[model samples]
Target: MSDLTKLNSPELSQFSHILSHAVKVPGLIFLSGQTPTDSSGKVVEGGIKEHTAQCINNLGKVLDAAGSSWEKVVKVNVYLDDMKNFSLMNEVYEKLLPSPKPARTCIQAAYLPNGVDPVIVLNHPGQIGAGYAPVLDCHTAHIACKFAELLEKIDRRTNKSIEANPKTIKSGDSCIVKVVPSKPMCVESYNDYPPLGRFAVRDMRQTVAVGIIKSVEKTDKSSGKVTKSAEKAAKKK
Candidate 1:
């Protein structure tokens, strides 16, 4: 239409009818935010990290169609349902984008369309290394060795899951580990895989807790000094 250029691609056709993936003019281009949906419009498997990867991939397709590339991108806006995922998302983002990085802004949303609620831990053995970052980001060696070590300790303690919070960090081997202590409440009915399916469950077997560590700080041991309620006490003295 006129001098405006609209772009689309088979790889990113899921929302073609609803919206243009990108639009280019004489000197500038505007790109729509790509979600984790595949060609068929279904949300992709894997957790936020994987989803973010897919989104970037989709953007690549759109960029290619527009005759542009990551190197040309001037800005990026990332929307997350949970801000805690900032680190994990960074991991994948750093791997994909070009040097110097694009001007970017990330904001947490109360909800994402695919129902990726961060409050639940959605890793079943079938979807191992699926959702939560500590597990999802681990490699085969980490799982086979580090995870096995943690599992052995759990087995010895007669526990289904182990808690390593406040663990003394004597070595890299010693770090926090998380697990679902009980069976997931909405398991058999949901099989989408990883974090999305897990987060999609209408009800749960128990309370849910899964995610990355945000911050840690040392507290002051000194007690607070009492102060007079009013300056009148000093004046009277």
Candidate 2:
């Protein structure tokens, strides 16, 4: 872990600008964190209103690049450096509107320069099938059965009762049955991982169930050492 005390948080004079002239038509114009700065990137001597207007003007150039005006933007996201100046920003912001106003949200999320993907968690140790994973770069087979046994032990210790999440994210939330079967017994989807989507179901290994669960495949050889492709992708995520 890095030292938080040594972290760098510089007081920026002006926020950055991005421009793309390739795509035409109704384009997006981002008015980024417009701090007080002059045309030469120098700090200007003015109030927040001046800096805010400059930011709006800079966004106008971006809008012009697509041969459309700022009035064409259907959406707008605002960044408030000074909460005290929010009303000032709003008053200036309303000027950009012609007849219909853009949909807007007022909050303090970071000023991300461009688009980004949503992140998700993987290998949740508390989740089912997660215990089967090898720890600390250890061999997966060595601890694979340990994880399975741990489940049986947990069931017996906890009276074999389990609860299913009503609005579950995955099949791992399946309920565990306490009672023993009479004959031709089968528990339920008690060993399945949480459904991650079509990708997870598609990339599941046939051998994980056959070899690991049923012991049908010889795992003593390197050829037998394999993991679900979906699990690999999940790890990457």
Candidate 3:
């Protein structure tokens, strides 16, 4: 198609004869799946975490060739050789992508090129559901018991300036907490919708802390604007 423009990265020139790193048309860019291969087309050495980073890094080159960036990516598809590596792969992924992360689908693949552990495809500038849900802030009202949890901590060395690790929190401690919903739900800021913003921290029959939602970060489905909402509700104290 004359209108379709193929985009190729000099760093990934080896793929030119077989495939374009990406294609562009008007307002959208479609990027091909990128593996952990380097410019020489050899799989990089490392574990799944390192492999995932390389895959996203390769995509970055294609995005640059297309005059686009990761922030402009609206959808992504991740292929993993094993579901067990999902968490390890996500460790690298969450750090690389920017706020309001793109909509993504990850599934296990029976096999991957070059025996790589992961492959990623990216699509730019379009609406796909509500986009990624990012926690704006979490304030702990109270802690009922001691537990270990993965919490986001400041890491100036990383691009995102934040990293997650399991930290032991003691009972009766007041600390910041992060909540991740298992599925996408319509959420509003506590300031905007009290009823929708309220939430409770519970584990089985034990109610930990009850508090109103301070804010939720999400991309509007239609306008694509990032919005925050708060909530007010009751919880067992």
Best-matching candidate per lDDT: 3
For model 3, residues 91-209, the per-residue Cα lDDT tens digits are 99999988889999998865555531111111212221122222222232222221123233332122131434425223322223344454345554444443444444444343344
Model 1 lDDT, full chain set: 0.48
- Clashes (N, CA, C under 3 Å) per candidate: 1, 0, 7
Q: Model 1 clash tally?
A: 1
Kindly indicate the candidate among 1 and 3 with the higher lDDT.
3
Pairs in clash, predicted candidate 2 = none
Give the better candidate number (1 or 2) by lDDT. Answer: 1
**lDDT for position 161 in model 3:** 17
Q: For candidate 2, lDDT tens digit of each residue in 1-237?
A: 231111111232222211222233233333333333444444355665666676676556545543567667777667663477788877877775565776877665432111111112232333434234331111122112212222221121222224332122232222211111111211112112111111111122222211011111112335644322111111111
Which of the predicted structures, 2 or 3, would earn the higher TM-score when compared with the native?
Answer: 3
- Estimate, for each residue in 98-120, the C-alpha lDDT of model 1 and write its tens digit: 79899999988654544522223
Give the Å error, residue 78, model 3: 0.5
Location of the lowest summed lDDT over 10 successive residues in candidate 3: 116-125
- Model 1: runs farther than 4 Å from truth? 116-237
